[model samples]
Target chain A: MNRYSLNQATTKYWSLEDVVAASAKADLSWIGLWREPVQEYGVERSTKLVTDAGLRVSSLCRSGFFTSTDAAERQAKIEDNRRAIDEAAALGTDVLILVSGGLPSGSRDLDGARAMVRDGIAELAPYAQEAGVRLAIEPLHPMFCSDRCVVSSLGGALDLAEQFPVEQVGVVVDAYHLWWDADVYRQIERAGARICSYQVSDWVVPLPADTLLGRGMMGDGSIELRRLREACDAAGYDGPVEVEIFNQDLWNAPGQEVFDLALARYGEHVA
Target chain B: MNRYSLNQATTKYWSLEDVVAASAKADLSWIGLWREPVQEYGVERSTKLVTDAGLRVSSLCRSGFFTSTDAAERQAKIEDNRRAIDEAAALGTDVLILVSGGLPSGSRDLDGARAMVRDGIAELAPYAQEAGVRLAIEPLHPMFCSDRCVVSSLGGALDLAEQFPVEQVGVVVDAYHLWWDADVYRQIERAGARICSYQVSDWVVPLPADTLLGRGMMGDGSIELRRLREACDAAGYDGPVEVEIFNQDLWNAPGQEVFDLALARYGEHVA
Candidate 1:
């Protein structure tokens, strides 16, 4: 119970205040937040809301699009990430999830885009380290490789993370993104202490036309959620298990209903 | 031109006779065949038609749904695969592509499902070897991992292929399925002589309602088709480069138009 956290995205319609209050009411010790909601609520006010609710921020949703081909756009993104780092620090969360951007528009240079990601991280790691925030790379599923994140596997994410100090950069193990991988268990073991966050969501198929909103709730789909949670535990990660589903159906449901259902499913399938 | 083959699926609306005739008319030396159409045209007649057209069958499209949970069904699938091997031999193509089935219904044991695939192949490999047919594992993109092929990467395919004799088992390198993999180049190099088929299709996104039909024509999407073809060549794969797109738009277009365009694109981007 102490380790379970509700990522606000799971209940996308819920206000920051409402989610924080609901988490506090449910006696959850942690909550995961997104950059937009936190900024909308005013970062300091958002921090106070969580703090008053006695909830710690497990992680920030994301900050990374370092695959731009344009120099100015790339530099602007880097600066934006620095602000994200400061936000994570201000919220008192050590982990800021980084979704390495996809291929540059009209370019087929995957290797070059990946190199730019590495360079982006190298530049930001120092700043993140000083701010006491870890830039946790979240390897999205390969389905999103061309348009979303080029870092499409846990091993690939670890390869990028291992290039820097362990404290400065880490990886997130999101079951929704990685449950299909044959090498997932081995990579989880390899992640060790570098796994800063472990997010849970089932992967339902016949994915809607918008593949981004296709994630299922825990236990509702085919993923071995408990097995993955055990693997993360074996990897020396004792952090919050954040429930971060992004389903249109779940988002359309009442926020409280979705929140309560996520808690129940997590307890049954992921605890 | 001698190395270019047109997989019949790219022209799904075309009768097998039409595709083969078009391939022959275009001076193509090879044609890739699917089971249902060949079974429809009569395997003996289909073989003679290709032979009469002076076209050699590059490979047989499929046969391996070895992941059924039912004992009777599993046995039935193994027997069907034997027929498929005999069919491949009858068609005079040494390569029989295998799409390992998805997880059992209501099951989340991915490792167990993969093991079933291995066991199925093991039971059938000897028969395939006797028939002079090499079982080619086609690792689908991870998006299809749940409802389609459980074998989801070239590395995973190689891991299974290496367990058998090189002559008995090989892997298919389909650009649309494998281009997103970070370790693809290394895996291709490692595949070496274990490569039975190299299928080409670009991966266009905003994937349609039916994701299966989302493959784009060569040079129409994000894949580095020429780079991948070069890598396969470097790895000693001098076999037919089969153009195997599955886009709904292409299927609706005139077969001759699509066939000519595939040939032109192969020369421009994949050859």
Candidate 2:
């Protein structure tokens, strides 16, 4: 329980205040937050809410879609990521999750898009470091390779991160995005101190019509959640395990109900 | 054009006779086949039809689902694979593509499942070698890792193939399944003589309701078809290139039209 954290996105409909109250009440010491809702509730207010409730923010949800071919638009995205770093700093979290976005529209230049991601991170690393935040590169599943993130494997993410200092850039080993790789265990070991966040979500197939909502709770699908967590722990990641499932059904459920169930499953499957 | 082959599944609704006649009329010298349809057309009869039309069978579609835990069932599948080897030999094609199926029903032991695949191949290799057929492991995209093939990358497939004699085991580098990997080019080079087949298909996004039917015709989506084909050629694969699309839309289209379009796309995008 000490290491368990309910990423607010697990019950996405819950307000920041409601999630804070629920986490504190449930005796969970850690909570993961998203930028939109935190900003909506006012970052200062949201920060106060969590701190007052005696909970720590695990990580800020995301901020990196640097897939533009146009120079001005690219700079604009980098600026937005700068604001995300500010939010992460303001919220007192060291890790800011970065979802390197997919290929630019009307282009199939994957190498070009990846170069842009590397360049974008190099630009943001300084700002994030000054803000006392670590930019965590989250490699989305390969299905999203064309439309979501070109950094589709942990190796690929590490390739980008190795160009920076470990404190400036790291990786999020989310079970949903990485469980399929044969080299995951070895990569997890290589991740070592570079593992900024360890996220939990199962890969459920017959994925939803909107595939983004297809993540299942810890024990509901094919992932060996506990085994992966064990690997992360063995690789020196002792951070809070963020249960960040993106399921429509869980979102529709009562926030408390979803949180309680996630907590229980995290215990049974990921602990 | 001598290097181009129309995989029968691309025009799936076309009768074997129709496809053979079309290939002959179009001046194509090669055709790829699937087990079920060829069996239905009668393996010997189908072989006669192709040979009579002066069309060489490029490669046989598949045979491999060595994922069962039940002993009897596992042996049964092995026996079925032996039949597939016999069929491939009868059709006079050296390559028989294998889609190693997903984890067994309700099984999450990926290592154990992969072990079964290795053992299954070891058990079948001698028989395939004697029959003069090389078992070609086709690694589906990582999206199908759980329910289709755990062999999800060209590198992973090569890893498995390296365990066997190069003449007894090889791999399929389908552009659609492999285009997203950052290491694909390097892996293709590593494949060398182990490249049994080079399949062409585009990966269109906003995947359809039936994800299996989401493969696009060569130019319809994001894959760098010609680049991958060139990589295969540079890796010493001078064999016929198979166009094995699984799009439902293509199935509903006229067969000759689909064949003509696929051939044109091969010239435009994959040749």
Instruction: State the iRMSD of every prediction, in order shown.
Output: 0.6, 0.9
lDDT of 1 at A31: 99
The true-versus-predicted C-alpha distance at residue B42 of model 1, in Å, is 0.2
Per-residue CA lDDT of model 1 for A1-271, tens digit only, reads: 9999999998889899889999999999999999999999999999999999999999998899999899999999999999999999999999999999999999899999999999999999999999999999999999899998999999999999999999999999999899988899999999999999999999888899899999998887889999999999998999999999899988999999998999999999999
Per-residue lDDT tens digits for candidate 1, residues B117-214, read: 99999999999999999999999999999888999999999999999999999999999999988899999999999999999999888899999999
Off by over 4 Å in 1: none
Which stretches in model 2 have alpha-carbon errors above 4 Å?
none
Q: Isolated chain A: TM-score per model?
A: 0.99, 0.99
Q: Which candidate is the best by DockQ?
A: 1
Query: On residues B125-231, what C-alpha lDDT tens digit does candidate 2 reach at each position?
Result: 99999999999999998889889888988988998999999999999999889888888999999999999999989988898877888899988888888888889
Reference contact recovery of candidate 1: 0.76
What local lDDT score does residue B185 receive in model 2, on the 0 to 100 scale? 93
For each candidate in turn, the TM-score is 0.99, 0.99
Q: Candidate 1, TM-score vs. the true structure?
A: 0.99
